[model samples]
Target chain A: MHTTDTETFEEQFAIEQRLVDSVVASFDSTTDPRLKELMQSLTRHLHAFIREVRLSEDEWSNAIAFLTAVGNITDDRRQEFILLSDVLGVSMQTIAVSNPAYEDATESTVFGPFFVEDAPEVTLGGDIAGGATGQPCWIEGTVTDTAGNPVPEARIEVWQNDEDGFYDVQYSDGRVSGRAHLFSDAHGRYRFWGMTPVPYPIPSDGPVGKMLAATNRSPMRVAHLHFMVTADGLRTLVTHIFVAGDPQLERGDSVFGVKDSLIKDFVEQPPGTPTPDGRHIGDRNWARCEFDIVLAPEQI
Target chain B: MHTTDTETFEEQFAIEQRLVDSVVASFDSTTDPRLKELMQSLTRHLHAFIREVRLSEDEWSNAIAFLTAVGNITDDRRQEFILLSDVLGVSMQTIAVSNPAYEDATESTVFGPFFVEDAPEVTLGGDIAGGATGQPCWIEGTVTDTAGNPVPEARIEVWQNDEDGFYDVQYSDGRVSGRAHLFSDAHGRYRFWGMTPVPYPIPSDGPVGKMLAATNRSPMRVAHLHFMVTADGLRTLVTHIFVAGDPQLERGDSVFGVKDSLIKDFVEQPPGTPTPDGRHIGDRNWARCEFDIVLAPEQI
Candidate 1:
């Protein structure tokens, strides 16, 4: 080494690299294999990101403060962390990695942070919108395997925000509406009465919303109904059927949950049309969308 | 694009990568260039890490929950997020990146979460260990520039955990001790009475503790005293001097803060040994350490 007072960027970078190596080596004592791999890789990638940006101390502190705010506002009803991941495309990416494209199986998307473990159950073709305010819509679909065989008894979970862009849980009052779980009938057909999903902003009174505003991005997601269908011996499908031609879809869903195949036409019908299941709807306009679900075999 | 139902890993990877690209491009409309760059780099690196590991949905949710806990517990007193960053070597790495190596000047370290602004001012050689229980120790240090010129009137801020391993702030009672600010004298020499720094553990009753336990890493930091020195036209030094031969140093500091050069001999004195300032001591043992700090120019 020449005796030069100047430390080149390469030399300076080498010092930082050694610190990274030490951190990586420190994790060598980790006993669990997966934990070891994860910690090591995470350290490496995280350091690489910092080094790439040469992140300033202020920036780092700001990030810590932002994340802390996100956590502080998060409770049983609000999860700003998941909202953060969704906007960054991480949630969708995880779904893509876990559920491979198999034989035209229904695409999977993020199971947003709002799902309650125990949703009210509804009978076949019964109204599932308990007390939410919205235009009553009919959602009909059949659960079937990739081979076109009926997946009888497949459990279907559906939830959507009301017309006011608020979930039932978002209200302070204890209310359980606009969410229900039902099992497929013997014919693999399922139907329910729910509100027509309208484009709505994700929780915007939190840090994620601040981030979006800072970046000049919108917080609204495309109109869509969330679905999670599970059957024995089949890969559970977590996806959404986007309302066709929604303006938000043209602008792109904030959560990146939209796939062209998942977009379906919600045909509007005049008032007093004959009900599919003889349920009366006097003088009220309704909408209908058919979303057929196909399950892939277990172990993608 | 070819007709291949096999869906090779390469193809799947490409699909995932496209999502990364979309997320990156989404920030194209960001008004601020720095924000744009930071957001895009973060997105790319984060997605790459996830794709590299094929991070499972469960793992993602777990990470979200862990971060939520970190945020929930972080208040004015405790900062779990910074602790998480410190243990992962991110804080130290950021310090290294921001402060480059200069002409044999004092090294810098993390400005740990415990520092309080406007610590009680102490006169030269005055005791700073007010209301804190510990063996009285004398700390003397000279401040100078790299050219060996004395830097008088330099502000030196110092703080450390008590012998009980808790900062004054950690106590429920409103008390300040073991911390003070003083200016170097005309000769650049300064001394203060404080507790002999001892080893301690970071707050570990939260998710970060569980993570350390799962990874088999000890949570104890080496014995050290924190110092921050600032003067006109000199870079502020946020650093620590380790008590030489501390066992935790051998085991490695939990925050990866121990540097060989920063370890100084904290000489123990038997009872009746006169302090540097000739303060009367009954029968209690004491320790002393000299830490002369050389500052780099402010522009570095």
Candidate 2:
């Protein structure tokens, strides 16, 4: 006759706590209470998530494979895994959860996968289109405090896709780059000529793509422009302003970037005299869009 | 004046869903139901976990660092990351949550990190323990059916630490290099001479070690014998039997391998007649323990 003892799921979870306690007892000199709390909380949640899922061998192996692929696809230029997070809404969710805005402050959105340092500084009213192929538009925007006073000299880092649906940094020619760092003028007003953004597809050639493919999904993003607005005594706001009438607007993006308050209509403007680009603007259909941003109280 | 739109968390979650939907909808051929389900569920849980944590920039960076360290420590002979999982209970939990045992079956335990594939096979009654460093004992056990009939020719892989707490596989030449593979005799009895296991410390020179140190935990494991038991018409069982009175028993192991049913007492055995190892009389202090295994039925 065989004798046996059965251990229940609760017993197993309790066993986990004991083991964790033992492990935690070994720390030497980490006086950071916040770090300790973070580690403990992370361990608890990670353990609980494992128990709740009842994860299996094949499943664990596949997760390892997915992570391996995420690393493999990451390089200097692109971060496919971060893009994965963005598309999955983790990035935006994190932004929202950590940076809740004060009433009347500009809301934050995803800092998409393409922001870079060293974008060439451009003067006020300098066109950012860089001869890129896209719909010609005059974009004017203001930065203001919650009290409606103009906050002059606010920095705006503007970027968007070209008519061909690609960033200048994504190409070899280094021309037609869509990024311009400009300061708000004395009246908190800024205007620059640019080509209207076209809908673009997030890169789909990695494990994130395989994951999306396995789920029967698309990779298209809606028309939008990324903005980073910063000023003294206020927290920086990372956000995107999307075009109003893009088909993908109602459909939304694969990256959770659309906000009703951030969308603006683009109205056609009568043509004017051509600038120095040797192209006469009066003959072409021109468009105009205006948006104003309000800053939030700084956290630190 | 700023225009405002009130957005609910549900609305945010819906927008997140639409984003993932767009990304997933472009897939051409995803016929595997399991893969399809896994992809979507992984995305959903991952999204939820991020929101639940409200992960911040530094936190995210640290997470990346932790995973990178995990990958860096992984190698062919030593999978530190797998050891990390074993310590964290993920490995055992993965197996256990999926493999519920029926009545009369032996329980499973963590497959510790020290398994080596090149064990030398020996016949029944062989001196698997090649040295006198450990307390000499003959391990005699039977493999039997749930009805108590002997299971002939069953394969058993036995490995343990010497009295000084070191495995043969762990050192190039340690006395009582406790490792042996033996088969059951015609009557289903198997015997091997080996020393009594002593408590041993797990390696503490990696990220897992760092984590343990930070948590204020010990690195010692309870005395135990590892076994891989198998027979025809029965599913394979990988398990360990722990020494009953080891000090590490009270606090449990950092790896959480102590199961009540798998704990056994190691009693002092009386000497027998002259054995093959050249001892004239049976006057030496020896240890004795026994373990009988029951296996799950095969599918066909």
The local distance difference test score of each candidate is 0.89, 0.70
TM-score of each: 0.96, 0.73
Best-fitting candidate, scored by TM-score: 1
Q: What is the DockQ of each candidate?
A: 0.64, 0.25
User: What are the per-residue Cα lDDT tens digits for candidate 2 across B184-234?
Assistant: 888887877766777887767887787767666677888888888889987
Candidate that scores best on DockQ: 1
lDDT of 1 by residue, B1-300 (tens): 234655566678777988998899889999999999999999999998888888888899889988988888888888888899998999999998988778778999988878899899999999888888888888998999998999999999999999999999888887988899999999998999888889999877888888998898888989888999999999999999999978787788888887788999989999999778888978989999899999999886
A74 Cα displacement, candidate 2 (Å): 3.8
lDDT per residue as tens, model 1, A157-220: 9999999998888899979988999999999999999888899999888889999999998899
- In candidate 2, stretches whose alpha carbon ends up further than 4 angstroms from where it belongs are A1-53, A75-80, A117-120, A123-140, A152-155, A158-182, A190-195, A250-252, A266-289, B1-54, B72-84, B112-140, B144-209, B217-233, B265-289, B298-300
The reply for model 1, stretches above 4 Å from the true place, is: A1-6, B1-7
